[model samples]
Target: MKDPIATMKSFNRQFQLGKPEIEAVEWAWPQEQGETMFHIINVYTKAAQFPRLTAESGYRLQRVGGMILGMVN
Candidate 1:
């Protein structure tokens, strides 16, 4: 996808890489020892997409499967 920030894994990788734009991260609760922890990473618009996106630019999710990330204006 043109906007790498459009997906959960990509955004998580960004967070692991210390991307400053990551606003916050949400982790699945009820953590169990040795169990995989799921995450929901929140971030603002992609730097490359910020300029091109607009209130009128129209919202579009590159994908519709799984737990899709949410968008805000």
Candidate 2:
């Protein structure tokens, strides 16, 4: 699909150290089909601000009897 949203959602892969999963998406611009757009995934923008937010949430590291909690995803 040529749709940017679809391409982004299809990218369910690890990015860096945190293994952050993009569960939800919110864009500042109106997303219209067949409309040319410029998308930026950067720390300066909210679309790319998930990592810092998740980190600040203070998720606990779960350790049990060989059952590790997966924060990624």
Candidate 3:
């Protein structure tokens, strides 16, 4: 990965707001504690797909993952 934050931002950018399917998926996720677990799964999936990611990029992903985990906690 070039930049994890950038990757996440790009992923989010691709997200279509106001799309009922996405909203429904989000709503389907379990509340409260589930968000952190979900983001951890997200980061793991990203890492598995992009194993050659740069150090800073990986760090950024972990950092963001941590932030997400914190917020969800």
Candidate 4:
């Protein structure tokens, strides 16, 4: 199985969109001092094999609520 982290990196390196599109890959993690924390996951790239690559990777985290919410390539 392939690694999700490595795959994400590779996908990012291979895919090339406009500057605005490329900027969407950034993620923001919340930092709450006393309350709770939140993280926003946003990925933008053009990889047709992304789904298949992730599927074969046995990514259990995806089922546990970690979502690939926004994808624009």
| Top TM-score model | 3
Across residues 16-69, which tens digit of lDDT does each residue of candidate 1 receive?
422322222112111211221122211222221333334322122112111234
- Candidate 4: 10-residue stretch with minimal lDDT: 28-37
Q: 49, model 2: CA deviation in Å?
A: 3.3
Candidate number with the higher TM-score (3 or 4):
3
Which digits, one per residue and each the tens of the lDDT, describe model 3 over residues 8-63? 44443443222332232233223212333564336533442344555654555445
Q: Write the per-residue lDDT of candidate 2 for residues 1-73, one digit (tens) a residue.
A: 3665553443323231233334323332233233222232321133333444454321211111012112222
Error of 1 at 48 (Å): 28
Q: How many clashing pairs in candidate 2?
A: 0
Runs with alpha carbons beyond 4 Å of true place in candidate 3: 1-49
Q: What is the lDDT of candidate 1?
A: 0.27
**CA RMSD of each candidate after superposition:** 11.9, 11.9, 11.6, 13.1
> Where is model 3 poorest over a 10-residue stretch in terms of lDDT?
24-33
Ranking by TM-score: 3, 2, 4, 1
- Over 4 Å off in model 4, which ranges? 17-23, 28-42, 45-73
Pick the winner on TM-score between candidates 1 and 2.
2
Whole-structure CA lDDT of model 4: 0.30
TM values, all candidates: 0.19, 0.31, 0.38, 0.26
